[model samples]
Each structure stands twice: as structure tokens, then as C-alpha cells.
Target: MSRVCELTGKGPITGNNVSHANNRTRRRFLPNLNDVTLMSETLGRTVKLRISAAALRTVDHRGGLDGFMAKARESELSARALKIKKEIEKSLTAA
Candidate 1:
């Protein structure tokens, strides 16, 4: 699996590690990705995703998967997440 956050599309960033002796080396700063199962109130199902810790906090703050997906940008979502978002929208509209 990739090291990208499924929710926020956070990926590894390139930087440099500077030594005290004035030496620098290339390094990667990766997002804190975790495998989590978040529940969708509208769909009444849990979806699994690899997301950053910050994204997880945002999800909780936004009031769960449904709320987050409702406000999430389509470009930032992975294919799986986009499908889930569509399903949630369809369910909410059909109700």
C-alpha cells in the first residue's frame, strides 16, 4: 500500500537532514498514516482507510465519515474514498 492518506491525500514530502557539521542529506517526511475504520451514519456501514492522524481528528471534528465526505474535495480523495462518498450521497438523497 502507498504511504498516502486516503482522506487528505497527504503524501511523503522531501526535505533535507542537516548535520551539525554543515552537512546535509536528503530525507523524506512522511505523514502519520494509520489504518482506521470509520463509520458512516448515512450509509450505516464502516469504511476502512489509511489516513493521517490529523485527518482522523478532522473526521471526528466534522462529526464522522458522512460529514467529512460531504465537505471533502473530490480531487483530494482516492478512488475508494470517492466511491464511498458517492454511495453516501446516493443513500442520503434516496432517503
Candidate 2:
């Protein structure tokens, strides 16, 4: 999968670069992505994902890294989760 936050659905953003000379240029604002191995309690396997720091924060804020991991491991993706994942992918690609 692409670099994204699976939990919070955070991704890269597009923007402009401003120069001291008053010139505007295109730039990509990338998210802070990290690779983490999530153990799937249901599947009984470890799955890898590239996600953003903010996304991780969401998981942490919700419970903690272990809680989120356990959720992913045991719980199947709900409609909301799939929708959010799709949005994150779209934003990352667009940026």
C-alpha cells in the first residue's frame, strides 16, 4: 500500500513555495510516514503498513499503539474505515 495513515487517514498535501523575491513555485508537503508491522489477531499474521505520524497519533490518542494494533488485528475493516483509507490514498496521490 502507499504511505498513509490507516487510522486517521492522514496523507500528503499540495501547496506552493514562496520565495523572498515573491515567486511562487509548486511543492509537495509529504506526511511523516513510518513502516510498522501490525499483528492481525484474526488472521494470525503480521501485516506491514506505511502510515503517517498523525495517524499513529490518532491511534495513540484513541487508546495507544497496542490498543490500535489489537483493534486492527482483531477487527475487520468497517465501511467507515474503508472510506477513510480511500480518501487518504486519493489525497496522497493527488499531492
Candidate 3:
């Protein structure tokens, strides 16, 4: 799988590493991603997602996966996460 955060869309960034001798080297800065399984209260299931550590903290701060998904913008989420968000919304409406 690609090194991308499903929720926050955080990914590797390209940059140059500068040295003391005024030398520059190409480098990539990757996001701190973790494979986590978060439980969805509305759907009554656990969803596995590769997301950034910051996003995980945001989910915790927002009260849960459902709350985070509800508040997150559609453009920021990955395709899979967008689908899960839709399912969560549907379950919420059904409940």
C-alpha cells in the first residue's frame, strides 16, 4: 500500500537536505503513519485504516471515529475513507 494517510491524506514530501558545506541532497519526508483499527459505533464494526499519528490524535480528541469522520471534509479523505464515511453517515441516519 502507498504511504498515505487515509483520513488526513498526509504523504511523503520531497525536499533537499542541506549540509554545512552548502551541499544539497534529495530527500523524502514521510508522514508518521500507523495501521490502526478503529471501531465505528454507528456501523458496529472495526475499520482498519492507515492514517497519520496526528489524525489518530484528532479522532481521539473528536470523541471517536464516527465523530471525526462526520466533521472531516470530503476532499481531505482518501477514496476508501470517503466510502467509510458515507457508510457511517448512512448508519447514523438509519439509527
Clashing pairs in model 2, backbone N/Cα/C closer than 3 A: none
Can you tell me which runs of candidate 1 are displaced by over 4 Å?
none
User: What Cα-based lDDT does every candidate model obtain?
Assistant: 0.94, 0.57, 0.95
| Structural similarity to truth (TM-score) of each candidate | 0.98, 0.54, 0.95
Q: Write the per-residue lDDT of candidate 3 for residues 23-73, one digit (tens) a residue.
A: 999999999999999999889989999999999999999999999998999
Query: TM-score: which candidate is best?
Result: 1
Give the C-alpha lDDT of model 1.
0.94
lDDT of 1 by residue, 1-95 (tens): 89999989999999999999979999999999999999888988889899999999999999999999999999999999999999999999999
Ranking by lDDT: 3, 1, 2
Put down candidate 2 lDDT per residue, 45-86, tens digits, no spaces: 455566677666666565744446444522334444554444
Q: Ten residues in a row with the worst lDDT in model 3?
A: 86-95
Pairs in steric clash, model 3: none
Point out the higher-scoring one by TM-score: 1 or 2.
1
**Judged by lDDT against the true structure, how good is candidate 3?**
0.95
Model 2: lDDT equals 0.57
Stretches off by above 4 angstroms in model 3 are none
Instruction: Let me know the TM-score candidate 3 reaches against the reference structure.
Output: 0.95
